[model samples]
Target: MLDFNRRLFLGLAAGGAAAARFGAARAAELRPHEKELYEAAKKEGQLTWYTGQYQAEPSEAIGRGFTTRFPGVEVNVVRSTSQVAFQRLSQDMRAGVAQCDVFSSTDHSHLAFLKQNERLMPYKPQNAAGLIKAAQQAADPDGYFQVTYLGLFLMGRRSDQVSEADAPKSWKELLDPKWRGKVAVGHPGYSGAITSWCLAMRKLYGWDYFKALEKNQPQIGRSSADPVTMLNAGERQIGAAIPSATTLLSISRGNPITMIYPTDGTLMVPAPSGALKNGPHPNAAKLFMEYMTSPAYYEATRPFFSESLRPEVPPPPGSRPLDEVTMITADPDELERDGQEVKELWRDTFGV
Candidate 1:
């Protein structure tokens, strides 16, 4: 297997390529609490946030807001895919670099990994109890690593090619012969969101469901964004368990797409945030984590159409309301333990 750190660097570079393509935006108007956190960041002098949330515009917007809030503190935002981010963070911890101070990614396993390594400290940000209870429970009892947000959805092209009623409403629906070559999915091995969804299936339907999915000859893409791209381009007619908002964002650009949370079930992934146990800048790291979990900082990224785990926050436009969707539950710890076995099973069935 490739070294996780190198892969992370490559993913970060790939995302940086996108950032270069889209100019960064200044922080959107700040609310009162955001202003206070911004001042705190300024006092800290520097903050670093490494994330797997790879949408370019939102990433830049986040960086810009941090910059705006803390003019004195330079925010170095490293954007990468979650697989690479998790591997790199693991390698960094082992190598003693811990380049990331505050780590936020869609991968809950990485959050579990950080916990096992004892690389995270407990900290309940000011408003800890308000977020989703499942997400809050995932955090350290004392509040070390908490879920920042989660993205749960299914999406496809808006073109009449696939009617809303015909869209895949359950995991089993993706395996229909009609979608044989038409189905596209983000790589389960590489994407936390995709993997989390798979894990949910394993927990809900058992290993047999995954075995069947693997046989479906699903086309797996390296970029988490590719399935949406393929659907928007009309290269594929259906995709499931992707970030629906991403598909909707394409729709806004006239790419012709629509999304729905499956009635049968949807897997909610807590995009987690944590502080390195021995980070280069501990205080700044804590400040950043505290700020991000805060509602003010949370809302700043909403325009990108992803869901925050906080219940008080609303789901983005064109996305199903959380309560309306059926959700499957999987213990993060159980998923972490069985993760490798799960990936191997995927390869065996899918021939990936």
Candidate 2:
């Protein structure tokens, strides 16, 4: 809420510089398994990562950071929305082509489905132990997939257009007639975060919640990040399901946007990543998995406002601690069971 002052900005800069130094130092000395994987991965030359978690810029920056840390191995980043990435991976499987070495999606149910189909390789990362307890608990018990990215799905408003006093305080307030034509959201069929959000809303208030929201005529986009884009461009006054990291980055860049932790509960989005069983670069995929969970990975993503999985690495500036907010999350079993139904209902309710 414009509280990100010069002092905080300077502190963030200093923190980033220190993280970078630490990453460089860590890269100079690799663990035994890492060194062995590096030798095998170097022979493979590269790994293809199908990522549906972060934006294109941040995803590519992670790829570059991985390449910088482990020379001679390249990372090919293919970024898309969660559903789209899943569809592409499904197509590749049907065609018998091993294009994606690693799969990272915001929807945990996707990993569940893949594991059920025996599409994911079962390999636990050594760095997984370094993750926070909550993150560790989110991982698959059998090690088929692990939570690699954590974010919050909350509300946001264009500060210049909507005063803080007038903004909606809870998810139910979004359906008020006064906010008609002013709200922006993402389609559950296209975004995994939105799918979880829709599921949570349904569980709490029933499908009538969205039925009422439809009366407001909210603008819907493909990605959950799109609502922030709409608010930043002054095209929308409110965002019903916005990613906190994206909004914080926009605010830091002087965008007239502010985050609102809904009084009901903020949605906790835990994006999971796994290696494909039939991937072309098996060893490289394993190495990339290790890199994604390491401190160096958090360092590359801290500037983009990505939440830290490791307790040693503090969260980025202008972000709320997870403990301070009431969080709503759907488990993989629930997500796997209801994901398709949510998508179908979303299209029926919104006619999109």
Candidate 3:
């Protein structure tokens, strides 16, 4: 009877141990770099990342990369347009829900707004010193946000439809009678990139530039990436403001698309990432902030032709180097002042 009782007790104990191991999600086992943060994040077990930087497919890949690196931490990505993401974050805060741990948007002004409100947690990335000068300049001085990527609006077209000589090599060429009704552009209201591009163009040329372009009746879309599909489908002969990364990725896939770095200048979008101050998963969020600056993160982003913010990571193959391109970007203050005005103007002009 004694032996029977002992055996039964051991069996129960082992079953209990097994249940603890696999019955539910646990904290991720800490790594050398993330050890200090691992315990806290492990307890949290998951983080919600609100991203306006990438679409669903690429965002999921990034989340998977984070999970693969940290065994116990799961990344729940909320991907949407930059303005939409901002609106959602705003709504969540108003509702008193700490649902978002990290927020990344292509619009730089959002960082200033969040910081002004003390909504962002000040955390310097361990890899900040290794980033390029431009990327460094884009980061918040107090370390509330860091520029993770740089995407540009370049002229792109169907490779078969437009020969090299026939392609519009400058922004001025887009006004040619040839591309009228054949050019596609993203709406500023829906795309942050477009907002900046509109602001920059208005600064450089004035609202009259948009007025002239309006006469062409360009096909407008919501996402900056829309031009890639529209051009590939031969629905448009040219794109007025296609994202360089999307165009490069499409070309790599054998799509009949070719990107052009305009002789005049290209609109550069510096995407910023930040951790929420009152996040549900603070440790996980900070760890993610650090992870984004690591080479491994750049490696994961390479497949999608993401423009690298880290100096060590090379530009996506076949794309022009940043230094060689004339990239125009608006100051955060300028964005704050004129961003909404540009979007409202875009809607009025395009009527979409």
TM-score of each: 0.82, 0.92, 0.88
lDDT of 3 by residue, 1-352 (tens): 0011223223223433443343422224444667777667888899999998886778898999888887799999999888889999999989988899999998888878999999999998776665655566658989999988667788997879889998999887887777888999888887888888888778777888898898888888888888777988888989877888788888998998888888777777778999999998999998898778776677678788886655445556777655466666666778888999988887787777
Given candidate 2, what's the lDDT at residue 320? 69
lDDT of 1 at 229: 76
Give the local distance difference test score of model 2.
0.85
Top TM-score model: 2
Residue pairs in collision within model 1:
119-277, 122-144, 123-143, 123-144, 149-309
What residue pairs are clashing in model 2? none
Error of 3 at 291 (Å): 0.6
Of the candidates shown, which would achieve the greatest lDDT relative to the real structure? 2
Per-residue accuracy of model 2 over 203-294 as CA lDDT, tens digit each = 88999999999999999999999999888788889998888888899999999998999988888777899999999999999999998888
Q: Each prediction's Cα RMSD?
A: 9.2, 6.0, 15.8
Candidate 3's C-alpha runs over 4 A off are 1-33
Model 1 lDDT, residue 268, Cα: 55
Worst 10 residues of 3 by lDDT: 1-10
Steric clashes per prediction: 5, 0, 1
Query: Residue 144 of model 2: what lDDT?
Result: 90
